[model samples]
Target: MSSTATHTDDDLMTVPDVLHVLRPLSKRTFYRWRETGKAPICIRLPNGELRIHRSDFKEWLDSHREQVAA
Candidate 1:
């Protein structure tokens, strides 16, 4: 799929899926954020997969918004 491609509505994104659309980062750093409560909320499936709602990820990003100096 293209970089701009997005999941269909009502889709639950896997950890790697979410990372694909966002900035690339090491899995170590990503999990560190989760442990420190800095990353967007994630849920673990009964089968041990991590998932996040696209909408919730957007909300989390919005809440952490900051201005950058040009």
Candidate 2:
């Protein structure tokens, strides 16, 4: 990934931004995960838009990692 694609912990990701990285995943599925509390934590902006912090997104992804036996 290029520096431009890297996000800091404090960086806020919009739905489209996340979708870009999570391609092949539909917006409906993402929203469904959010509704079920399975997606990364997100904050609703004053305009009702959702944003997820980079750190939280990383944590969420990490939590779903599968362990393999050596």
Q: Report the backbone clash tally of model 1.
A: 0
Pairs that collide in candidate 1 are: none
Q: Write down the worst ten-residue block by lDDT for model 1.
A: 5-14
lDDT by residue (1-70, candidate 1, tens digit) is 6789666545677888767866577778888899999888888999988988888888887898898999
Q: Tens digits of per-residue lDDT for model 2 on 1-70?
A: 5666755899999999888888988999999998898888999999999999989988988999999989
Off by over 4 Å in 1: 1-9, 67-70
Q: Judged by lDDT, which candidate is best?
A: 2
Q: What is the C-alpha RMSD of each candidate to the true structure, in Å?
A: 3.7, 2.8
> What lDDT is reached at residue 27 by model 2?
98
Relative to the true structure, candidate 1 reaches a TM of 0.74
